[model samples]
Target chain A: MRFDLEIKCKKIVGGRTKGKLLLSKKPINFLGMVNTQSGEITNTSNGFERQNLKGKILVFPNSIGSSVGAYTIYSLKSNNVAPNGIICTNNVDITTASGCAISNIPLAFIDNQRYNDLVNCIKILGKNKEIEITLDTEEGKIIID
Target chain B: MHLTRDEEKGLSGEYGEATSAAYRILVAIGEATDAEKLVPIKWAHVSGVNYNTIGDSGLEFLREISKDGKVRVNTSLNPMGFDRENLPELSPEFIEKQFEIARAYEKIGVIPTFSCIPYEILPIPQEGTQVSFAESSAAVLANSHLNIITNKESALSALASALTGKSPYSDLRIDENRSPMVEIVNETDLENELDYGLLGYFTGKTIQKSCTGICNISENTDMWSLKSLAAGIGTSGSCGMFQPKKPSKFIEKVNYGKREMNETRDELNTSEDGQLITFGSPQLGIEEISKIQTLMDGKKFTKPCKIFCPKSVFCKAKQYGIIDSLQKSGVDFISDACTCLTPLINKKNYDSIITNSVKASYYMKTSNKVSVALKSLKSIIKGYTV
Candidate 1:
């Protein structure tokens, strides 16, 4: 059987979203930190340079950049490389929160323990090893594999 | 949340697609922030003009929104990526797209004031009035100095506010919510602009995410010092607002000794071998420009220097013949845009840049293709003059 685990998280943005998880331990400043076209993390502090954020549930601690970060998130959406969903470990700021809302991206907030456990789930990047995330706002569920 | 009939209709698309979109964002953010209702605003200042920063995706959104949206209140735009007077040498990748972004904003009824220091160009609203402002330095000034209510609006939120002339009534708007959570004591000698700017950095760092009460400020604190100080705080930290302890209505005192201030300054101070000297990160006002003019009265810069400001302030400053002498001294005056945001300055030309603005120092390293060294205005002048 496929590994199925349910994680309790606060649903910030509404709508059902499902994808593989792309996690960042550091908070991102969407403005200069992400390449909207390629969806790669540009901020060095993020520790995952050149990694794409598209088609994944981006997990970060929170936002810590310019106010235009919201627009950067929307740029991803229009460019067709937008993240399926976002999960913040601690809290979401006005910038990211507005970005997720504008682009209709699904966002959820998980506690520190569950976020760490989720991060550990995909620690070793190997072939056929990915943490699949399914977020349903209506049912208020975050099922992970 | 309570919504008036007009607001409900607008949210339901009574006004148009743009207004509907704007209202939806307002309501969503308002609900999320626990704001009770929407409040009308007297002015709105918007950011996100640089094409290099926002990309093609931003232009598309602006084009569509500007075509369909109508701004109900007086709005001022922030600096663009290119100088509007005459296009400076820029990379081919961004030459065309930069002006296109400005066109989109212009189409949407935004006045092409093209400035970050809108508080200088326009009349300051009476105390306790509400406004929706985006630029961090300007928003802090509105809250702390102007006594107006705003919570540092996001680009999208500020645009939405511009479309509808209303913002979510929360944070600084509520008189009760204005209580200071922390106090910052200025025990260090804040002699000049850089010292005050670094003091702001210390204050913001010491009390992250809290309304601040600044203590021991010199009685003769001028607008320029406040501008630099606020710019530093807004650049490094995400503080809501800061006020003098004596003037603040409520806040508990927190000691900010010289040791702590020095430590923070030491951390921010970096030595980088560079050439370009820049001023007007937040777009200097008349006072700061005049000060620079007087300082550089009989001086010439051996190295290349630049000043970024808007047309309004530049014209007002030029009337006194200060800009002419500075230009004669090899200072290039760039108007209607900021240099560090776009391809305005070719990174290959300069090794690094020295600036009095903490905000410019941060962006020069982060977005611009150059290193930054922070220096005081006095030192910068002294180096060039004597």
Candidate 2:
């Protein structure tokens, strides 16, 4: 991959991986709104409702709802249907941080500005083609090719 | 964040995987929150006991950690799925999974005090004692009523605290953050626990600060009312703690009048009638049960009634024959399981529930996918008691 953009981010949980970007403008609720068995977004209005998040780097604003959402994330990992990594744009709550920690998933955060930049990059690259990005937790950046 | 030699060792895996994991979680959270160091805590009350809430994921996590995990501090547990003494007709798998969670916690050296109201049953440490409480209502009450210190911790963080006996010295643990940044003026009289719950819901939804100042509620507000207020705040939003007095300095001000209270009520109260009437989202204390015993006054319930209380409280009530009397009045006492997020009550079993607890109302609607008809304790007595 010929990497170009490198956006600074904060690492909540460690491990580097590359995967297609799956973006959501709204905060996610893992407990009820995400199906653990299939890694599908269950909320009717969440845009990517029926889409499977398996192996994708999920980009979202943040997590909401019960703290048990942490367990739902862990459940996803245990069930072998989970995101490759998670990138939160706004905030990294205890629920998100702990969930990712327990599940050994690379979780990172970016500022709203960087989030906008990533969104623009995705827009320009077009959504039809899968956008593979490298998430380096140790480097604390999201590298786009 | 600074870590002592022992803390560093724990983080470096000298102590074991569980301790290392706990330290990592605390340090990560501490660094994120900009805490200077980890603080020692006297107690840790952990949540995530209910199988319905955590599902398979939580059970697996618990099993994995329980292998090497042991509590470093006095740790307590939250409510589980059902009462062991009076088991409801739950699925075999749910019962088995719920027991596995209990066994895991027991193996990890949790006190098995399967009640949300730790402040109610457990002996109070000093007023300024630092604790890690995952139960949101208990955390709020610890800060507001008991003058103890704790952030409204998530289930995993509190579990990490249990294993490590330390928490991040950030958020409400810091003295500066304890002061309310928002002022919530109560414009209407809070006549009952439900009203206080509504006021709390209003304050929590409106204020985004770590703590808020609640004016006009008397310092003499009773314990039940305070618990309701705590549960309501814990349910609706992330505002963890509150003060009964006006804030010395505040950036925002909001009012909790009849309109605001009605708005909250309308949001939570989705059903005009309910099939089952329930009490105790924060498991009913002995005092609350006693009050209910008196209120029953030998009258039977018009509808099926279930009262979720702590086993300790249930035993005491049973000793007094209050349980016997209430049982005669067709009130079923369920210990070790609460009304909120319990598999015992769900959309499959019941279409709607009647509850006086704002916390219960919120979770029943959202988590259980059932409608809620929120009523005051007094109003329930008036309408349901025959």
lDDT of 2 at B333: 89
Candidate 1 lDDT at B137 equals 78
lDDT of 2: 0.85
Kept native contacts, as fractions per model, are 0.42, 0.29
| Candidate 2 chain B least-lDDT 10 residues | B246-255
Residue-level lDDT of model 1, residues A1-145, one tens digit each, is: 6667777777667889898877776666576567787887765744775778889988876775366878889999988888999877765566777788889998777778887667655564343576788987556668875
lDDT tens digits, residue span B112-185, model 2: 88999988888989978899988878988899889899987878889999999999898899889998877898
DockQ values per model: 0.47, 0.40
Top candidate on TM-score is 2
Tell me how far the alpha carbon of residue B280 in candidate 1 is from the true structure, in angstroms, after superposition.
Answer: 1.0
TM-score of structure candidate 1 = 0.90
Interface RMSD of 1: 1.9
lDDT of 2 by residue, A36-128 (tens): 788887655456657778899999866654556777788888889899899988667667777788778898989889998898888877778
Task: List TM-scores of chain B, every candidate.
Answer: 0.94, 0.98
What RMSD value applies to candidate 2?
2.9
